[model samples]
Structures are given as C-alpha cells and as structure tokens.
Target: MSTDFHGFSSGPDSAGGAPRTVVDWITVAGDQLIATIKQLVADGNVRRVILRDSSGREFLSVPLTASAVVGGITVLAAPVLAAIGVIAAMVAEVTLEVERTDVDGVNESEDGTPPPSSPDPEV
Candidate 1:
C-alpha cells in the first residue's frame, strides 16, 4: 500500500531559529517499518523517529543525533533496529511520526519552507 505524509509545525527552538520543529507523519505497513526507518536515518536530517501502531499507541521513539550518525551508526542502532524488527513482525501496520531538522542548521518558515535569503549588504 502507498504511504501518506503531512507536516506539523512548531515555533522557534533552542537553536534560536524559526520553525525549527518540523514534524512529518508517514504511515507505512508493518513489514516496511525497518526499511523506512533506515532510509530516513540515512538521510541525515531526521532528529527523531517515533513509531506507533494503528491505534496511535507509541511503541518506540528513536532519537537520532548528528553525532550518532557521524560516529558510526552500526554500533548505536543495531540493537534498536533489532527491536524494531520484532515490533514490525507483530504489528500489521504502523505510523511513523518523524521529525526532520535542517542538517545545516538553516531556519525554515512556518510553512516548512526554507527562509528567504537576506538582502545583500552594500547594495
């Protein structure tokens, strides 16, 4: 089955930026859970990945930091991924409520689009 996606917005964060919290919701089949999560993590922008069942009960929340990615993921994610595999087998469907931030620390507008560039100096 095809997946669905939508964005949820929040205000400025500790980074002192506008719309730093952009959450995207993706619903995927239980069998596709691990693959989807791996893809998202590899993108290197995701701040956290929360998996929930059809009934909206959160099963696991994987918080991924930049360091975790740069430091080698296999060491940190192997166990967690194994657990996710088990969960995927037991559930028929799951919804991924994932948070993606600007990997470069760029700020985004309320609509989840990048902020407009500032005017050049000494025009």
Candidate 2:
C-alpha cells in the first residue's frame, strides 16, 4: 500500500497482514522509531540509541548526544543522514550491475579484429 503522509510506498504484502498485518506494525514502528529518535535528540540527556532488528539482530548504535559536544546535534544531523542515505542509494543503483551474460557457447571478436582463419580476413 501507499502512505499518503510521507509519500512512501512498500512492496507487496507478503507478511500476511491482510488488512491489518505486518504493514501496520511496520508503519507504527516507523512512526514510533522517528518519534523516539526525535525525543532522544531533544532530551539532551540521552547518550546514545541502539537499534536492533526484529530478530534481535543489532543493526545500529548511534551517539546522538555526544556527537557534537553540544545539544540538539541529533536534531541537526537527521536531515544530513537522510540525504546521505538517499545519495548512497542512488549511487549504488548507478554503479551496481546484475545482468547475466550469455557465455555458454558464444565466441566474438575481442579487439575489433576478425579471426585469422576467416574467409574475409583483412591483410
């Protein structure tokens, strides 16, 4: 489905949330996660925030309060982080290639030169 508020869209519903499945959890989690980060940034007492995956996998640990030795660093850093992420994703898409080459039994010229045994071989 599509999120109208932020214009974000997710992939197909595979987690079986039907009308109220994992998507709801994801949406709620996203909202809560942003709010929690903002809160931690605003509190100025928070030293850091450790985030983990749903399967208990440690994903990231960020030092927001001590990043800049000043208050409100996280608040200022959030947009920069987001922009970096977007730029990184775009670069990845531009640099990464996954096409399959047909190398089974194909033989072609390598340096714009035909084979020596060809009938029309150049002198």
Candidate 3:
C-alpha cells in the first residue's frame, strides 16, 4: 500500500548484531518522529526502530540490516509514516525506541558487556 506524503523517504539499512545503544523518547508530532527516524538511519548505525503508544503497547518494530536488499524494516516506514501522520492530526504522544549498532562490531549484552559475535559480514 502506497500513500502520498510530502518529504517522505526511506530509512537506512542496519547491520546485524545487538545494538550498542537503545534510546527512548516521547514525541508529540509526526514531523519530529520522521526526522528522528531519518536521522537515526542516516547515521548508519541503527539496528532497529521501535514505536509504542503511551499505554506501553508496541505499535511498530523495524529490525534493520545493512544489506542492499530493502525488506523487513525498510518496508514498514511508509505505513508507519501514514499512521503517525494520522495520529499527529489527532495530537497524541508516542514513544520511540532507536537501537543503534557500535562501530567496533561488539555485541553488548544487557549487563553492558560484550557478548558473542555475530557471523553476518559487515557491509
């Protein structure tokens, strides 16, 4: 399904492995949401993008990878944008989870230690 929106663009591909950092934030506008998404992807370190409502319900989760083939997380951005635009019109708050990868290729565990390495070749 395709919908027209001004300034809409695809996000970046993520690398395989555990994210180096998971950032959480509350946004009140779709534009901000789009900007944040684009910025995270543009940085070329993001591994996932998760969206949730104020009720703590996960609405969307985009697991990204650095492969040139665009699938998985890449296809969801448009729908997400459409939904966020609709939600923006109604004026609501949503939570954002941005998972970014580390440049050193170390997988960080929940305890903040490097875990086992992934076999996926770096892009």
Candidate 4:
C-alpha cells in the first residue's frame, strides 16, 4: 500500500483561519486509505478530504474544521472513517485529495519536512 503524491497550486482563500491553503493528491492502494486519512487528520491543518475512485469519480467529500478533533468530534468522525474504509476496500486503488492550511506558518509538505526558510532581507 505505497503512496504517490503531488501538490496542486492553492487557490484564493475565504474568510478565516490560516492565510494559505494547499491541495495535495495522493494515489494509494485501497487498503491504505484509512491510514492515509488518519495521518491527515492528525496533521492538524487539513481543511478538506476527498476520495475518488480510479476513474476519477469522487465518492466522498469531508469538510474538516482545521484538522483538529475536539472532544465529541472524534466520536463523530469514527463513523465517517468507517464508511470511508468500507468504500475504499471495494476499490483496488483510489486518489485522496487533501486541502491543508499553513496554520501558524507550519508548512505541511509532502516529505514531512518544513520548506526551507528564506534569507533575511537585512543580511
């Protein structure tokens, strides 16, 4: 259940939260969907999650409130995750589209590494 990912250029922002938004596409085997989604949830910056089958037909769109699971939200999310798992298991492979925010300037790059900092202008 390996994954291949690519990021798309972020679009205009709406009122609220982090100033920047980024979208990433991850292609993964069906068995790995749950793990991927869980990791994204834990990242604490994802704004949305969309699952699509091999044909590019989207099956699920999950709108998350800035990736944090507060109290009873975790309980509510469990059923959604379970439903995603069941749908994923029926397909061979699927694409996961994620929209993440750069909360407090924390970069959520694909490699799990922060983007390089820029040189100070005064230097």
Q: Per lDDT, what order, best first?
A: 1, 4, 3, 2
Runs with alpha carbons beyond 4 Å of true place in candidate 3: 1-28, 68-77, 104-123
Better of 1 and 2 by TM-score: 1
Per TM-score, the best of the predicted structures is: 1
Model 1: what TM-score?
0.73
Q: Write the per-residue lDDT of candidate 1 for residues 1-123, one digit (tens) a residue.
A: 767666665655636644366677777877888777766766666789899888889999988887866654563467898889999999988888888774335434556542333111112
Q: What TM-score does each of the candidates earn?
A: 0.73, 0.36, 0.50, 0.70
Model 2 misplaced regions, further than 4 Å: 1-28, 65-69, 73-80, 83-123
Higher-scoring candidate on lDDT, 1 or 4 = 1
Single out the weakest 10-residue window by summed lDDT for candidate 3. 1-10
Candidate achieving the largest lDDT = 1
Q: What TM-score does candidate 3 get on C-alpha atoms? A: 0.50
RMSD of each candidate relative to the true structure: 9.3, 23.4, 12.6, 8.7
Clashes of each: 0, 1, 2, 0
Q: What's the C-alpha lDDT at position 20 in model 2?
A: 16
